[model samples]
Structure formats: structure tokens, C-alpha cells
Target: MLTETYQQPLLDSIRVIDHPEAVRRFFGLLKELIDIVNLPNGDARLVFSPSRREKGVISADINFFQALRIQRPPHRRTGRGEVEYHLTVKKSCQERLASIEELVFEPITEKSDYVAVIIGQSNAHLLTHITLRSCWEDCLLELVESNKRGPHSARHNSDVYRAAEDEALLSDLIRLADDPTLAERGQNGTTVEEPEADYETESASAQQPHNLILFGPPGTGKTFALQPYLQDGNASLITFHPSYSYEEFVEGIRPEVLGNQITYRIRKGIFHKACMSAIQLAGYGTLADCLNDTPENRHRRLRKAPAHYLLIDEVNRANVASVFGDLITLLEADKRLGAENELWLTLPYSQERFGVPMNLFVVGTMNTTDRSIALLDIALRRRFSFREMVPDPGVLPIIDGIDLPQLLRTINERIEYLLDRDHQIGHAYLTNVTNQADLCDTFRDRIIPLLQEYFFNDWSKIQLVLGDNPSWGKDPEQRLIWVRKKYTASATTRLFGEIPESVDEIVTYEINPHLHRSEYDQLPVETFIRIYQKPTL
Candidate 1:
């Protein structure tokens, strides 16, 4: 085990290595350095130690395989037995730590002034190769640099080889590791805040809302609206359901089975991956990228920040309170990737600091009929801008036999009157009707079943929306219906001393809607076929 006495003295002798022997020494010392820093858990939890003071730590873990383990019952594990006294230990030592997939490394022939000894376990529980020199520094620098030709200079890389010239250089090294912003700031200087009007103009020109929900009644093309963006690789799609949780969407400790043994691992969820990808695509090489006013550079940076869209289908299906977790604050427009109010989070499972990027846009689709938007979590609703995607009958191609748009509008208007706008049918249902048979089939199958569910099996209310001719009464709202049925008459009693044998008879009577009669079943289909029949030119 590495001890306090040998740690600080070793940091003074740290050097960039090119030779294989020197690389071996680097890894040997790296293992000891990791032990001394108390990073066995794959996260740095100590800011100040016997060997170091206020050193910033960046914990990056890589995985090459996948596995599954129990998710419901969280397991307990042991940690360093001593009472830890460290400012960076935000969580207690006894807290369950995430078991992440072991990183796989191979040797690369490249040289650089610095190396990032990314420490991780392999699937076989063996130490993978130390990514030496060029590869190593690239890995380390990627945490800060947005692209090649970033802020790092030869002098900055050589500083780690020699003893600290001053306390300030040590502070700079820590910042370079932990805070990318600080490194960028040191290279490009500070950023001047832009006027609110200019910021608003830039935002409007982007045409991408940080968070948006596209919603309306069913079949309003809410999901279809995402196709153009998805085709361009600008959008990612995910659906939320009742079973989704913060652990699945954000981050959490999940169990994994590796070679007949159970192990826990911290896994990155879909949202986290999207945010990281957006940050990389934003082309934010330095603070200058944000503050530079040169027309060509500004335009290049803005264009380089390709908007990433996260389309959430059925956004309301999941428990919003549980799924969003701490992400609620980070989803704000100003808190986006390159926004002025950008925010970062120290993930609970991996203890890694992460933030949402501005270029990543969240687009969600919801069917208001299934669940009312008004009942949604106020916090989630406030974070997203809502766009109404009601039925647009005018966009449909003119069908040969049917006045499709008019029919849809009439049905929706009736539905709106009977129930509410939320339950109205969308125009897409009738947009493809080309003949009487097509119209009949649509009404009989898709349209009626949906209406039945919406109205709780009330066919009469459905008929009113379809504008079917009344069969039993003048008023469409009337619930009573006349029906015909076959029954055996049982009159064996004598009225005036005479008796009669029982006989079969057919009867008709007015029955209440509670019985839910099916006598008018064929009427709606026939009526729709007649209305949709082609007219002579």
C-alpha cells in the first residue's frame, strides 16, 4: 500500500516518458499514486491529503463490455475502515460505490509532453496497459480541449516534469485536470457578457429551444415531426414509460454478473451520453470560442455547435419527478451547454462532475388525451416550452371521393363540444381516404375503437362525433334505443278462467343507454360510405 511519507516526494519526480522502461516506471508509480490518493473506488474523493493539498481530481472510467445484475435490491459493501477526514469526501466511506465496467487499454506509439494515466480495471480484473505519452496526454487533454490546437503549450506540459516553480503552477495543474473552463480562461482571457438583446437575437436565430414538448390529441404528427432532425443525425430518440427511473435516465449503481461473480457498476444513462456528445460537438475549444467577436470565427463556432436534439416520445408516461432528478435545473435554456447559465452536476453514482450542453435540445411528444398536460409535474412543464400540434387537415392531399379535411374538422368540432379539445380526433386519420371502402374501413376499425376507449364504450357518443344518422331518435344526444329480440312467452295462468300454452314471439322496446345496445352497429359504417362516395363531375 502507498503511504503518505512516499507520495509527495514522488510527485516531485514525475516525468513524461517515451522509453518503455520509463513507461513501466510511470505505471508502477501511477499505481502507487492511485493508492496514495485513495482512488481505488475509481473516483477521487480526497482534495487534500498528506502528500497533496487542494488538488483537483478528474475521474474518467471506460467500459468495453456489457452485463446485467439485480437492480431492485441494492447490495452493501465494505470501504476503507478508518474514519476518513477529507473535505472532498462529500459521501461517507460506507456509502455504496458504483461498480463500473473495467477499462481496456492497449499500447500506442506516440509521444507527448504529458500523460493521463486513466486508471481502470479490465474485464478479467487485471490492470490494462497504461496509455503512455501521446495517447495518454490526448486522453487527459480531451477533458479540457474542445479540438486539436487547443490551449496546451510545450511549457505547460513540461511544468509537471520539474518541481513546482511556484504554488500557482500547482494550482493551475489542478484546475487543468478538474475544471476545463479554467484552463480555457487562462489561454484566451475572460469573457465579456453580451447584452440581453443580442443574446435573445442569437437565441431566436438558432430556432432551437433548449427544451420543448410537442403535444396535442392523438395522430397529430407529434412523433412524425422528429423525422427530419433524426435523418440528419441531429436527434436522438428515447421513450419514457412507467418503469423508467432516475437511475435509468441519469446515473445509478447497477449490478452486473461477470464470470459467475456478481459485481456492481456505475453506468451512464442515455441522457448523460447525449449531454457529453453535445459538449464535444459544440466546438468550445477555449473561453475565446465564446467571447471572440471576429465574424469568421464567430460564425464557425456557431455553426460548429450543431444543435443536438433528444426526442422523448411519450414524455408524460414516466414518473417525471423520479426521472428528471437533479436534471430539472440543468434543462433550463440558460443552463444549456454553451449558455450563460450553464450548470454542472457531480453524479451521485460515479462522483464525476457533469453538465448539460446548450447545443443539445430536448424535444418531447405527449398525447394530451391519455394524460392531461395540466396534471404534469409543474417543474418539468416549466422547463420545457410547449408547442401545440393540433390536427392540420389542410395539409392532407385531396382525396378522390371524400372531402377529407371537412369531415375531420366536423368530427373534431363535435368531439370538442361533447368532451373537450383533448379528445378530438386528428386529421391524419382521414388524410388517406381514397374511396368509400377506405373510408368505411377506417371508421369501422381505427376510428371507432379509439372513440370507444375515449368515451368509455358509449357508441352513441361516438356516432354523434361521426355525424351518423340517428336510428332510434331525432336527437343525437338521446340515450334510449329501440331493439328487437326473440323470447318465449310463458302465459300459463288463466285471466278469466282460461289458460293458454307458451309460444315464441318477437318484441321491440325502448331501452336506456345503460344497457349499451349494439342495434346501431351497421348504421355508422353505411352512413360514412354514403357520405364519402364519389360525386359526378
Candidate 2:
């Protein structure tokens, strides 16, 4: 959730403002600042650029040279109700100048240690923890002279920023610990059963790393969402797909050539990495952390390191046996490292425990559109709750241009017509198509090709949704191609006014080709790109 964005300060400023409807103007200005700088932290100084027009040219005015002083609460929620803080700006009209609260420290040259203007004001205002460059101490002399408020004022040098971070973390922990639906009525549900068990890092739920499932199809934003959970704790991500053998997912014998000698190395596959990560996180150090780099000896130092998650991308592609290997016992929710649960498989190398560690969550994603995925074992299917990651119709209305509200209704009607007869195109595919190109081009090339892949038996489905009567071909495959090509042409014409004369005329390109495309093979790629997109152990 840590965004590499310059809008942090502007957004933070917006959050400090409590009024509801009035915040709209503030939000617009904040977004304007974001677009102007484009830089992560808005490195541009508070320059007095009054001469520039506010059209396409972007710039900031000097607000800091003058100062404004006021007082506010330690923690105020944004309109969305998240805890935050803002600057206390008070400008006396008679004085003809604005003054700000005293800054915590000052700014300097180091990028890592300091970001002037925004960061300087942030430390002085919200956090007060002043992460500063080496020159901050010397540069702060200016603030001391101008600041109307005293250096040690309760508002200045406050620990409110650190306190806010801690508060947010605790709040999230509380939300995760109690299954909100299971809370007893009349009870202060926020009041935890064990106040000491604040961090789920040591909780029973965190051990069941297998309880989760990565729900998005390829490029459905699944990995992007999973990264926060991975970075939040000691976690590992294992991607599963057809041809991802047990040898690749679990432990396997890796052949080594030593001169004339043939050596067998017990190479740890993705599962080995996941387990080792889990064990190290459970309190046990990693094999590399404690022992030598030889993979054969890694099994020697295996212990609990309290893992938090084991994300399995496209899990349905691989056999459950290969994916889980010998770690079934650690994955069950009831079974934990210390606490006992229903007897099942014994861990091969760790302490006596059945089921994944209580803190370990197994999150996997599956694409139901893949007919071959029907090969998924019923037993594994029964264990996981499969929530479809289809694009919500609500999102379509939010998309700008082309009468999306009307387009959405048409999409639903077509989808309903398809689903009523056993055909169901995923919403994720639609969203992906919609996201391609600009507002004009999206309706033209991007969505049409994808819509062709909708897999509907009813020809009318295309006819109703596609606006004009689709020039569906006589054959099914031909019809699908016709749809793709027609839509591509329409979208292109809408975007660029007409199809390009040559490759150079094309305005834009896309990187994520639909996974449904079969032309991409013979190269060992998915394992690295979509699979290992997650950080390693």
C-alpha cells in the first residue's frame, strides 16, 4: 500500500480537511499536482511561477515562503475515514502573509534522506519523526526564525505521525483477526479476545497459509494485489501450471556434473522455497541463512520461522499433489505448529504438526475459462472456495466515454444471453479489453478482439452487444476471427479516425497479450513472468 507517488502530501492535506462536499475542489487540485510533477515525490520546489498559464503547462506556486499557523487534532480521518493529519495553516488578512507551523527538521540534498517541500512539510506536519538529510540540522535555522509557534509547542515535534502509523497497523490487524460476520451482537467486536494478540504474525489464522486462493486470471491484477501481503510478512509465492512437475514444485533430484562424476543434488523446488520461507518465518532460520549454499544440505536446518503466506498463482494448472507436495498438514486451518489438530500427513522435516502453520495462508488464482482446468481434482476443488474474479458491471459505468452506462447494459444483456445457454465469458477479460488504448480506441480495437473470444453460442449475443449487426462468418472459428478483426478495426477507426497505412501509423501498443492466445509457446516464459513475478524467499 506504500505508493511511490508525489500526491501523498497533497492527499494528506486533503485528508486533514474535514468538510465533506468541499473536499472535491481540493481533490481536483491534488490530482492536478500529481499530473504536473509526474515525479514520485513531486521533487519540484515551491517555485513562484505565476507567469505560467494553467492550461497544459503545470507548476506549483510559492506557499511556503510565507507562513500560516494554526492548531488541529493529532489524528483526523480522511473523508474515507482513515486516520491522518494535516498542517495547521492560519493567515491573518491584515498581515498580508501566510505562516505555517514549525517544521520538525529541515531539508537537504540527499534524495534518500530528504525530499524538499512535500517531505519537509510532511515531517513537520503529520509524522514529526523527521527523516532528514545530513544538512537538515543546519537548514532548520530558517524555520526557527520565522515560525510563530515555539519549537517545543505541543503541535510541533509531535510523535503523532509514528502514532498514526502504529494505529493504522493495529486497526488493520483488528479487522483481520475477527471474522466480522462471526462477531456476536452487542459485544464490542473491536475489543479483541486477547488484546495481547494484536499482530496476526503469531496468530492461528496466519499459520493456515493455505486458506487463501489467488482468484484472478492471467494479468487480472492478481499479482499486484498479492504483493502487499507478501511484503507485509515472511511469505513465498509459488506459481502452478500444467507441465509444472512435482520435481519443479516440490523437492526433486537435480543432476550435477562434477568433472567425470555424476552428482545428485536434492534441489528444493518452488515448494521447498515456500516451506523454507515458512519455517524461517516461523522462527527457524533459512537454510541459506544458517548453513552452506549447497541445496543438498538445506534440509538440515529446517525449522519453524512463522510464515504468513504462500501465494499460488494459476494453481489449477498444476496437479494438487505436485503443488502441495508433502506439506498438506501445515495448510489446514485447525492444525498449527504448537496447537494440535486432526491427524493427517506428518511433516517430513519439521516438528510434529498436521496442517499448515496457523499463520500460513495459501492463496491461489485459477482461470475457469480454461476448459483444460476441468482436470482439477474434485478433492482439491472442495477444499478451496472459488470466488470468480469477473469484472464487476459497476466498473463499466465508471469508465469514461462511449456511453459506458449504455455499453454496460448491453454487455450484461449479451453476457446473460450467453450464460443462459451455458456460455460465460469472464468479466476480467472484458475489463482487460476495456483498459486497452484511449477512450476512443478502447471501444474500437481493444474490446472487439476480446469480445470475439466471448465463447457465446448465440450469434444474437454479438449482434445485440456490438451495436451494428456483426459480420459473423459462416464457421465458428471464422466468426470468432471476424469478431476480433471487426472490433479491432472499429476501435482503431474510432481512436485514430481510420486504420493505419503502415506500422509506424499505429499510436500505441500493449504488452499483456490475452492468455487465451496460443501463438506464445515453445519458450519457457510463463514460469518466469507471471509465475515468479512475486518476490523470492
Candidate 3:
């Protein structure tokens, strides 16, 4: 009967509600309710009763709504007594609500009699909250099914539910609460998550630790791996170079001109801004709320927020210890703002106490070719969880009878043998090869140039990697690197007009000139095939 009378209207109201403001207010109210009730297991049945003294339990009555600035009229009876108007949870739903570790309330409208219970887990930390209408048995069943299949799949099938701006607003709250710097900025603060980027469906498994480094050589898709996290516009990308400093990565004093006077002020850097964004996304209304809240409360609240990323491209280029400074300790999972052993540091310029937010993930792309993982700062090594991204030849397709996978495998094998695993050529170099021309261009323009740099202009090693060595017994025309040899006596005579009897024979190597030709006609598909091909016995 309640479903027939109020279900459709409630669903419609939820669809059109000012989700951002509603979510903000909902969390604020939820916080107050939790604080007032102090439910031991973080579960409670809130009864909005008219009587201030309701025996044993605390009545979430007029004062509760008034505290949150929610205006409600006096009780009006239908068929039941004045008790029928009080907000009540169904008997069947009570067990289900009690089972949920953390209960987040989503307010549909100021005038709505029912409060929607959004069930979420602390571990998965999904951004989309599955809104379960109060007293609706069908909605509760759907919530259980959705939780089993995951939020996105549940959202996909549900007709009555919409993630909408409520998700973003929840994210904004979480981030604000997690980062004190953003809390210090107050309501007027600007965050990286604002001006929402295009939405993307992120999986529960994609939620990684607070600090992760994707380390590998060039073209290994280290930076590309971060696309899923960035699509939601909660990510900020910054490239680290030799010149990158603690001041630039964190906070620094910068010059500003006002009127005719040049004055300096402390400016928050990308990391600082990203932290603020992450904190704001976590759901605290103010800095005091973030700072004063217990770790358990913050962690529970953060579970509702989406994960934010600080993408550091070329992470190894900057001095890790110098760039991260004292805040490097906060990068650890246990030392983040809401962790068990939370830590904080006073920034050099701002002097504001700062800690990395639990939801702010630091995803860094480290080019091993630039700086090996072994050489990374000990402090950095201790903080971040490193995942090595190596060349996966299986991802390459065979193009025009050329096995691109084998080609990449062979190149990487030779590179590994000549140098180390870190210098291996990535499969991405040949991923786009569709035909003979593409292969030829790849070898000539990209592969050969990279090998030259890898070997530091030592063409002989390049020749070996390309299967151009004399020992391989390949045809001169077919070789990617052309070799030239001359007797020392003849070479001396050519250069100085005299032959030296003691001089040894001379050898030289060059990249096949035809590869530089506009058409790339000289280097056929066979040239690339031979690099990976073995001579028949």
C-alpha cells in the first residue's frame, strides 16, 4: 500500500532532486545523527517522534531536522493515529540495515516523509551508492542483488536509480574532509574534481593503494594505464623532471602583482591541490570536521567517496626525497590522513598541517630507462607499491606475414642480452604496424633511433640487435644496418696517403640508407621478418 501510494512519486522526486546540495546536507545530517545516537555498531533505527522524552531511545524529532535547517510541518493523520506519521523502518528492512557496516542516507526531497538508505561497503569504496527506498521490500531485494553484482552492474539494470550529481557531490565532500588545506579554503575552495570530466565505469578492483608506481621502459603504456582513474575528472597529472622541486610539487612562495606593488605569497602546488581535491571528495564539511574526526569515522565516511589520482609522469626524473620532502612519510597507507597510524607535516611555505588523503591515489609512471628502480630513493621505495610494466609481445598482431610479436620479442631479447631487462623495446613500437610500410617506418624512425640512444651511438650493438652482424650471415641488402669493412693498410693509405704495416683491419656500420628514402620501398617486409627469423639448417 505504501509502495503504491508513494513509490512512483518518490522515484520521480529522487530523479529530479538537487542531488549535489541534497547529498551535502544528507551527510551533514547523517554525521549529526551518528554523533547524537552513538550507535555502538554504527547501526540504528532513527524514529522521528514528536515527544522529546521517548523512554530509553533518543528521539530524532523536530530538533534533529531543525539542527540541519530542515523545516517540517506538524503531524497530519491519514487513517492511523499520530504515531503513523513518525518515520519508521519496516521490520523486514531492520535486519538488512543492521547488517550494513556503514549506512549512508540519501535525502530525496525536504518534504518527503521517507529517507532512502544507500548501502555501501568500506572495502570496495564505490562512488555510486545504491539508493534503497525505505520500507520498499522490492527495492531492498534489488539492493542485495546489486551489491552482489557490483554497483555499476546494479545501476545498469535499475530503472528507478540514478547516480547523477549525488555521486560527484559525495566525492567532493570526501575529498574536502580528507585534505585540511582544502578545508582551510572553506566553501569557496576550488578543487581538481570540479568541472567534472567525462564519466567512466571504473571497476572495484581498479581501486589501488594510495601510492602506486608503474615502472618500466619507454612505450610500455605506463601513463596510459591511468586512463580509467582520470576519466572522472578527479585526477591531476604532472610531469616530474630534473628541475621539478619540492616547492613546485607541494607548496611554494610565488610573486604576485597587486596595484603597482609586487608581493609574494605561498601558492599551493599540484600535489597540494590534488590532496585538497582528494580530501574534499571524502565528504567533510570543514577542516575541523576532518581534523577532529576519529580515524574510524573518517575511513567509514571515505568509503562513500570516489578514488582520486595524482598522476606523476616520469616520476623518476625528479629527486624523490627532495620533491616529496617530509610529506613522503604520509605516502604510506598507515600514515595517510584517516589511516590507523595517521601522520601530518607542516608545509614549508603554507605552514598548514598537511597529510595525504586515504582516497588520493598517487599513480606514478617511472621510465626505468631514465632511472632504474634500484636507484630510486630509499624513502620513496619504502612508501610506494611498484608494479613493473614490461613489453608484452602477445598484444601485437601479425601484419602482412610479419609476426610483430616475434619481432618485438626478438628485439627485447637481444636488448636484454646486450644490456638488461630494463632496456627492452616495448611492444607498443610495433602495435600499430599494419603493413610493410609501417614496419619499415617503425624500424627506421623509432626502433633504430631508440637502439642508437640505448647503445650511445655504438652502431655495432645496434647492428647485433637488428640481426645485421656478419656472424648471422644475412645478405647486405636485407640487413637493417649495413656494415662496411676495410683493411687497415688500405684505410691508412686513403686517409694519409701512406700505408702502415702495423695497422689492423677497420670496420664500420651504418643504418641502411634506403630506410631513409621517402617510399621505404627498398626495405621490404622480409627485412623485419628476418630480425625475428632463424636461418633454416
* Cα lDDT computed for each candidate against the true fold: 0.49, 0.38, 0.59
Say which candidate scores most in TM-score. Answer: 3
RMSD of each: 17.4, 20.7, 18.5
- lDDT string, candidate 2, 1-537, tens digits: 111132123223323433322233222333333222221121122221111111111122222321111112243222233222221222111122113233322222333222232222223333233332212222222222233332321111111111122233223323333333323442333222323233233354434434655453333556566677665444566677678876666555665543336655444455555544454433333332333323222222222233456677777666676556655544555443333442235334333223333334567777554533346665566566555554444544333223444444455566566543113333444454342133324433545554556643343445445432333113222122223333366677897897777633322322223323432232123211211122232
Q: How many backbone clashes does candidate 2 have?
A: 48
Select the stronger candidate by TM-score from 2 and 3: 3
List model 1 lDDT by residue over 207-314, tens digit each: 767788998999898988878767544456899999999998977777654334665767667787566445434434222333333445444444446566778999
Write the residue-wise lDDT of candidate 3 on 169-282 in tens digits: 345434543443553465523233232232222554255766889998888888889887776667788989999998888877776543336756565677876776566556
TM-score of structure candidate 2: 0.42
Residue 492: error of model 3 in Å? 1.7
Q: After superposition, how far is residue 424 of candidate 1 from its true place, in Å?
A: 1.0
Q: Is candidate 1 or 2 superior in TM-score?
A: 1
Q: Candidate 3, TM-score vs. the true structure?
A: 0.62
Model 1 whole-model lDDT (C-alpha atoms): 0.49
